[model samples]
Target chain A: MPNPTAAILIIGDEILTGRTREGNAHYLAGELVKVGIDLRQIRVISDDHATIVAAVRELSASHDQLFTSGGIGPTHDDITADAVAEAFDARLDVRDDARAILAAHYAARGVDFTPARLRMARIPEGATLIDNPVSGAPGFSIGNCHVMAGVPNIFQAMVTGLLPRLTGGQPLMSRDWMVMVPEASIADQLRALAETHPEVSFGSYPFVQEGHYGTNLVARSTDAAALEAGFAALQTAFPEGK
Target chain B: MPNPTAAILIIGDEILTGRTREGNAHYLAGELVKVGIDLRQIRVISDDHATIVAAVRELSASHDQLFTSGGIGPTHDDITADAVAEAFDARLDVRDDARAILAAHYAARGVDFTPARLRMARIPEGATLIDNPVSGAPGFSIGNCHVMAGVPNIFQAMVTGLLPRLTGGQPLMSRDWMVMVPEASIADQLRALAETHPEVSFGSYPFVQEGHYGTNLVARSTDAAALEAGFAALQTAFPEGK
Candidate 1:
């Protein structure tokens, strides 16, 4: 069977405004590949309700799993929970389960759970909580969409806990060969090799060093034999490659 | 008039595979903000033909301008040119202008202008070339979509030359303040402040350093006076913030 496919939707004005560099999507992409989930696409959008709702609906329906980061905080700009609810057409409020988790955590620290703080507990009607080890507030998985925090540390922690619960396919394996040659010189052969090996994916990344062009040729596949065969064929075609 | 809105579409398989981290989008986002272009959305999709065609059409039509990076090289994986052509319903061929640039560059270097090398000359009809200072292969702009190379150096070089030609609004300005307070404590006040100043965009980025939660409050606006007034209100509301 094919690997489970996923997409990441990021909601934040800070990212769109370039105040903060987006690392969550990159982090998730790396982690997803390790877990054998193919990250099909990533969408970074601003904190607009209509845009968020539309993206959530579109990505969730298209991919097997849709993971979203940002806008789950206590601030007014954190409207992802409501937007997600609207996307799935689910009732949203301060659900009792989420509220219980936040209440105890804050009470233990001698902090009052203000109305604004309680906004973090506002979850969709039907959703499973994804544990956040770093923060008291929890992320939720409603249908195929998993909503997580924007903070990198918190987002990573949530993903660590959430990934294991979902079913994954065999991890993709890859082999790389570098050669000091322009990509055009080998493009014809590379194309033929790629067409012959449908099970493997061929990638050619070009770089220039000391006025010489080099291509990092990579072959990736979930099937072990196919990966080995494809790599062998690639090596044969470019004997000078190493 | 509002700032010209733009979207970025990244076409690559390496990004989705986690083999490469996407930095072009971040770099361009920062540059666009300085030039007064509001970057609305960013989409990173695979090098699949159908997906590329769809995204090119969607992003190009939705925003005032669409910038695409990657898949313009000579390798088999490089099919962005064809996909873009299909999206715009333009006939793609080895245009003489682009061919002359590549032919002269290669001839000077004693490199053969093979069929594969000539693939770099293929341009969608009616497109103007975006100069590539680092490489001879040129990016093109057609139907409000500017196609650029995926290489970081090439992409940035293309953007530098392309931005000046497009119309821009007033440059956006921002003010940031860090406060050692939970966002919840300031959320209510922030919401009120934001409602009072629709001209400025209020962003609250939360962090947990040590055991204390802190928030970085940012106010951004194209209007200088609006930005100043909004920031002043924010300071008045959170007197302890600094």
Candidate 2:
């Protein structure tokens, strides 16, 4: 069976402008891998509504699931919720459930839940809200698209709560070996081995650590036997401590 | 003036698998900022030729310039050169100048330059080579798109070499003030300031450092005076030292 696939849409000016370093993509990719879903693509766009809307539609149509991070804050650039609504052709409104949750969360901290704070309660019509365990602002899911906050802490908590509910496919497996041989000298042999293992995925990453010419060969497959066989062949090509 | 914009296409499977944490986007963003070009969007796609071609076309059409990193290695997964050629309706050929450079580079290192190494010398027709001061395999540019190696060191060197040759607009300037205020509580006041300064782009980023409800207000503009004035107003809104 084919692995379930998902794409990440990181919508924020901060990420694209190099003002913020994104850790959410790595977190989401790791979590999705654990749930047997392959992260097919990751697109980081500015907070422009058109770009967000276009990316949402494109990724949602291509992948089994889509997760977006950023641009849902109560500021001028916080237009992701509206963009998602427009992309799905749905209406946006302040959700009562989300409001109550945010109100209770704010009340617990002795902060008044103002109208601007209610912006976080807004969700696309007919979408299911994913509760944020770290912050009161809830993430929502419309069809296969999951929209979450850009804050790493809040996004991670929301993902942990949402991942268990997803229907996963075959788990991804991999094996890796480091070699001292130059990449070009062994490219033809590696390509032939790659063709031989049709069920497996092979990657050769060149590295120059401490002024040494080496490459890391990794093979991934769902079939354990085929994966091991491919690894064995690759190991024979380059012996250790050479 | 509108911010000078550029987009990035990260072509690699290593990124999707969470095996590699990318530093290229950050490096390019910083480099572009020095050249007064705003890095507006960055998308990471698997080393699929069709996907690369499609993304290159889409992004190049929308943005001022498109920069691609990775998938130009001497391995089977390195299909970036072929994909870029296909994207621009050009043919891939081993350029004589590129071959000479690579051959000389390898000869200097006392390494035999094999045919597989010749794969690195291939360039899309009607493209200008982007020099790799550190590595021998040069990156090249076709139209508004520049393609570079995925390795951080090599990619950085290539982009640095390419930046000076490109024309850029005014540099975008920014100033930030750390405010000990919740986004909801200060949203109205910040909104007023933003409205007053139409030329500057203002952003409020909430943070919880040490369980404190605070936000960082960043004012950005192409006009240095407007940016500084906006920062001053934002700082006045928040008292010094809590």
- Per-prediction TM-score, please? 0.96, 0.96
Candidate 2, residues B149-206: lDDT per residue as tens digits?
9988889889888988888988877787887877777888878898999988888788
CA lDDT of A22 in candidate 1?
92
- Candidate 2 — what's its lDDT? 0.86
Clashing pairs in 2: none
What is the clash tally of candidate 2? 0
Which pairs clash in the backbone of model 1?
none
Every candidate's fraction of true contacts kept comes to: 0.80, 0.61
Predicted model with the maximum lDDT: 1
For each candidate, the alpha-carbon lDDT, in order, equals: 0.93, 0.86
